[model samples]
Target: MTIPLKLHVGGMDCAACATKIENAMKRLPGVTDISVSYGQELLSVTLDEDRTSRAVIEGKIRALGYTPAGSDVARTPANDAQAATAPWWRSPRGRLVIGTAALLAVAYIVSHIEPSWATWAYVAATAIGLVPIGRRAIVAALSGTPFSIEMLMSVAALGAVAIGQAPEAALVIFLFSVGELLEGLASGRARAGIRALMDLVPRTARRLRGSEVETVPVEALQIGDVVLVRPGDRVPSDGDVIDGTSGVDEAPVTGESVAVLKEPGSTVYAGSIGIDGELQVKISRTTADNTIARIIHAVEEAQATKAPVARFIETFSQWYTPAAMAISLLVIVGPPLLFGADWFTWIYRGLAVLLIACPCALVISTPAAVASGLANGARRGLLMKGGAALETLSKVKTVAFDKTGTLTRGKPQITDIVCLAGDENDMLAMAAAVERGSSHPLGLAIVAEAERRGLDIPRAFGGSSVTPGKAVTARLKAGFVSVGSPRHAAGKSALTPDQADRVAALEQAGKTVVVVLQGAQALGMIALRDEPRPDARAGLEKLRSLGVRSVMLTGDNARTATSIGSLLGLDVRAELLPDAKLAAIAAYRAKGPIAMIGDGINDAPALAAASVGIAMGGGTDVALETADVALMKERIEGVAALISLSRATMSNIWQNIALALGLKAIFLVTTLVGSTPLWMAILADTGATVLVTANALRLLRYGNRRSD
Candidate 1:
């Protein structure tokens, strides 16, 4: 059987490392697929477990000078003792940083104090610093990627040493080590946010054992285990609040700042803090099955799916490195052969050009930012499918909304009742009797109102018949009664002009009016209205402020749709059938990219028809599957959060791209004109990579200001 495995592989420095590992693993028998991310230090592989073992895979990575960390790797007492007694120079990265700093200082002192021995001292310094950097370069060369940044830097530094510029060579290697240190540190910090999220889940949980409280590992906690969460304690797992009430601070998991009140039935997720009360929660999920764990899994998967721009860059980079190598070769041979320039001068200049054009910074720019963006969104309760959805959301100029479950709560209530014959209770009693058997939401609302008013709602004696999406009819004590939409009821029941005017007035006020009939005579009108979500107007206002135009698409009457739209300051397209909503999306797409927000099986087609479909309510399987992005939160504000998150992510990606290309361009031009030295060129390339990565990590701060 084929199973997936993920390992944290250390020592991946550039995109070339990922490529090298991927290429090596693809040749292994029974390996189905592989994905490696330098930013996350993650290696995910699908392999036939019966045919190959993870030990063999780790062995292959170990041969390439990378350490693999996973569950199967056991720690021994001897290894622990060695780790504790390890010296400052035990860590290759840390040793390189310290050695480079010491060597650079020595080189500077010797160059000024003793000119005669300065060259030898500088040579020693370069050698000391080049040990770690040059080894990786050689490994990369043996792995078939000889044009990586490490390789380019190695070539440039050695060429300087051969040309009697030992001080410059030492400085170049020193700066290159510094850049690697920075990149490693930045990547570590980026992964730390995700690690911190994992840390929020306590290692052990307090579980009930008859009369004893047993301290057990969270992994040992199973579904239906009752766990106690004390005041100011993090919930051990995702479960229901069964014994106590408190305010829960879900900010760490869901980005909500205020503490939400939890009762007997409230859901408490793992990593949420129970602020002021002790609670007993019945575990609903296992340790690995909690919401936070699922979020982490989703984020890791999201990072693997490349953005459109990242794919283009990846394709461009396939030839970008070799093209850079070719250009450097031409720069070396072309100048000396064609222009009669001095060999050593042109060769040194060519080496500088090679280092300047390495493309490491440009290639690393997008995914780091993309990973950070995905992490940011996940922390905020917004599950962006991947960078592709985020990229699409950034360009969305028009946002279309479904009225029923999106803008308003899907639950409707009977708010107004008019009787043409008997008292209001008699009309409601008759209507509720027929509607009680109907499964429609409006029907349920009428029945609930009758129950709320203490009316004697009777059961239907005879068999009831209902037209789908129209009306319900059943035999009552008085006569055969029909309760349904105005048009549907008008066909089966008699309507007076005065009663018809009342229905029209109610419909115009955004109330969904259904006629109640006894035999052929219309008894009264029942008007129901689904109230707009409390945050609907505010969320729409936020979207408008962000320059996203809002449009309301519904199958309701014009006056009702207009009333809702005007209240929310949105463009209204009333009386739209499912096909009309799809056409509306296409029409909007003609002008610009449009996103549809919906949460119904009927809305699935329109959701799929738009540029990006954001599924709200998360109730139906069809809406979840059809939409591009599914919102776990049911509020309209989640739409605004998504838009804001997308804009920030895309903006960060562009900034990184521009920074990378801009630095490379300037340094490339400088190297060509003999203004930029080998050390400075490598520094520029390394600095740009570090800058873009650090800038991308800024997205970890996104959505921190979200309020309750």
Candidate 2:
């Protein structure tokens, strides 16, 4: 049996560290799969427990110079963040950098005082910092990772000292330590941005007790309990407003800059601030089920899945590192042996080339941009499953939409009532009784309409039968009642020309017309319309501007579907069953990668069939579980926004790659010619890492866009 293991990993600064650990762990017995997420600091492994155990895996991670949850290493930057608000010099890694600087300063002053003691002084300074780097390099080598950045740094510094360049070696070690400190600071900043989501929900709440409000922890707030939201306080949980009115700022959870007005019966999300008037809200979900918690979970899980471009770069780097090491070695020995060149000068250039060989900048290029993109999407109420989904969405050539919900609002309302034989109220009451407990959207709409009109609904006589995608039927005291699609009623008997004309007019008007029938006699028809979402037209236009096509695939009748699709200028494929929807998706795949957007149980098959599945609303559990991407808000614009964001992320990744390689390529040329200084080489490598991370951070602004 395969067992899954999940653990928090510490001290991994970039994707290179993750790749190193993955390579070493994959060589272990019974290790079926291993994934290390650098952005999330999480390790997920699948293995056969009979052959190997958690203890062995964790031990291997520790051996690779990373701090696993249970294993304590000599120094961990993750441990250093316990006083996260403190100055950088106070952390353990910070202290090392400070201490090393002090030693280098002391050695420099003494060397100036006595020329004879210069060599020994610099050697002493180099030894202080080299001890830790050398230990890490040796540990990494034994664990099957022989060419890590630490190994390159250690080898370069040691080789310099062996050539009687103690002063230059000391300077190299000092610069390397400072470079490491900068990397930690930058990586820590990015990680903190992701973790800040958890802090949005406050710890405590004000639960109402009779006439009084009592302070309590948010965890103690139960479903159906009303909590008071004072002005300027964030709502403690997902709930509905039951009292008062206020302009609530939802920017914290959903990136809208404007405040949303909250009134009675309005649904409010957790972590949104109530700006003006105080309101009492009834809790709907526990904290873990709220928007903030779910978004955090999604981002963390996404880090485990790499994009195709990322995979290619990682593979390229695996060979690139060893090839670089060979070239560095040739620079040191080849020229000196063949052309009788100056050995000392060639060796100095070789050390500079070694610094350029560290793959930190190249390794981090894609994941960094992806991490920022995920964060941006989360803030905008877009939840993509992973890097792969984010990348695939950008390639989508056509977006197929489920008409009832994706483009139109999923909520259907009663529009028109036609009377044939009985009074409208009496006929509606019969349909409502049969649909009283049905969870279907159409049935619920009927029940809600009947209740709103103050009709008296009698009890259903016996067990009710449902036609999967059609309607419901049950026996009433007078006779049998059936409320379903117009086609379902038409099959039983012929409709009068006048009645048929009315139904045709309603259906042509883009309304869903259902026949209310008693046995074979048609009593009347009810027309329900689900209007197109406010952003439907604009969003589709934006998609077209990006060179993507739009299509509507629905189970709705041809007239209704075409009418609705024409509103947004979309291609219509109407009257599709669930199987047909899946077939349509497979056919669309032949044109190019397609995305299916939906919000219902039947849409699941099509969602799974498409290259990318986007769930339209946050409320549907089936869509949430099955779709590759989910929009927490009903804003259709988010679909286009996410695709635009994905394209921007890919563009950002290419820029990072060019920068990482471009800088290294220039340094490599200069190093071979003995022109580039050793310090400048190490400085460029560290600078590249920080610069790539900083560039990725630019995507954070996407979260703050005023509107989609």
Candidate 3:
């Protein structure tokens, strides 16, 4: 019976790391299935119940220079606590172990000694130095599968002993161990990126109870609980500020380097640091529901979903391993037994062939490429949820964009406020007072404008109501004050012939006019417009260059959408409602894979429906949650760059896979056809592994040309 277990692993930095962990685990005795993801810092292992223990699996990871946390086996409290901390590489012990292993390997490799002596020395040193750290590998190999990299290595070493060639056997084990150690270190580096993200969420929060501060675990924080946040402290949960004020540095959360000034009633997210001042925030979400938690969960889920290419390798390996073993047996015993010739020499040669046919290189090729691609993306602020998403992104043919925040900046400002009847001050004052009680973006703009002009806004009058796409109505001392869309007010006979012309002119300029009326008489109008992002045009062109069709979808009128679309050189402009946008995405997906880029609550449904959804970092929670990929920087150019990077990554992965498999196939054939020497087989296998690894690492240097 295969028992599945989830282990929180540390020191993985990329998809390659996940692959390395999986490969290492599969080499264990009872491991039936294994999956590791650097994006989530997790390892999923399926093992035979009677053969392997959780301790054995964990020990393997440690030997590979990774820290395994959260398993069914015994765990130290300190280790569990540290699991909630920063990147694994930041830990003193993990660093020390990696540093020591690396130094020893380098020193041993550089030493000028006889091949036989050097081999034994390296093997002995690595076993002594890394075995204690990587006990999981030994235990896993011993308990479950009778054949593994360790088994092959041990056999090869003992074969030399059996033939009085102890030095040769030792050297073989040593070089192989060094290769394993190097692979583990690379994996650790890749996993560290995900761990860094997880570390952002504070483990505890300071709750306020009637002026007394009480420290409580973040998980215990409930909605509506007041939490006191001091300067330089990380916000423990997402909430609204009910008291105090501060400038929050949201760099870690939004990837924005600047500190945003926040006041009373402003929303603050978990993982953001309080740059200055104190704040008493009323928690609006639980720890599990917080933004950081959701991000972590999404990343983890994505990592678990395997890529199509990876799945192929796993399926192929099932038959490949058994077939290779059988072939080795035939070459070793079949011919000599049937022909009545000496078996010892041929058997020894067959064992050498078996050692070289481990398929370690082929198994590792695709994953290393995936890890490298993911890591490169992270450095450029593109957060792909997993290997599956990363693979899908490279194949996107058409991309749909949500207008607000996706193309145009989500923030709409009051560009011009005109008062027709009453004085400018009085007109502005009345409009701001009525809008103050509303939460709409337009309302916020009005309030912000009033505050900018140093105008004091009175509380909302009694019986205030807001109508979407229309306006706000308030019962005031003068009479009924209606503030809304120009068309709505015009329909109510509030606009004069001249005022109507002015409205038309403003509409032509892509500005939204809010008409303010008192008792059916026009008072004034406020003009607002969503600012186009600076990089929108350039990004659209770049996407076009990449052979991706760019389409703009907006709820605004056709003229407005067209005007913006034309400016950005978009191929299609669809003035659509929220449902229409979702339908549009569906329509496009019917043709082929489509990527939807959006950053608003309205875009959430469409994002979820698209083949791949990309969210702007500063977008709404709904958009972020729905998006498959999140770009931390809110620049349109980043989107194009991400596409380019994804394609580059996919190409690299395929190349590595081809190279590894091609080499393995050729070597296997040569061994079967002739008397393949032990040294030659070892050299070819190790050399091919190194070549694939180096090729994958080239992805790290991607985009360097542009920088240069």
- Give the winner by TM-score: 1
| TM, every model | 0.82, 0.81, 0.72
Evaluated against the true structure, the overall lDDT of model 3 is: 0.71
Please, what are the lDDT tens digits per residue for candidate 3 over residues 208-302?
99979999988799998999999999999899998887899887766566798878989888888997899999999887777766655555565
Indicate which candidate wins on lDDT.
2
Which residue runs of candidate 2 sit more than 4 Å off their true CA positions? 1-7, 20-35, 44-86, 209-212, 220-226, 239-249, 256-267, 275-284, 412-507, 512-528, 703-708
**lDDT to native, each model:** 0.79, 0.82, 0.71
Candidate 1: segments with Cα more than 4 A from true spot = 1-5, 27-32, 46-56, 63-65, 71-91, 105-115, 276-278, 414-503, 513-526, 555-562, 574-587, 600-602, 618-626, 703-708
* Global local distance difference test of model 2: 0.82
* Per-model tally of clashing residue pairs: 0, 0, 24
Could you give me the TM-score of model 3 versus the true structure?
Answer: 0.72
Candidate 3 positional error at 308, Å: 1.0
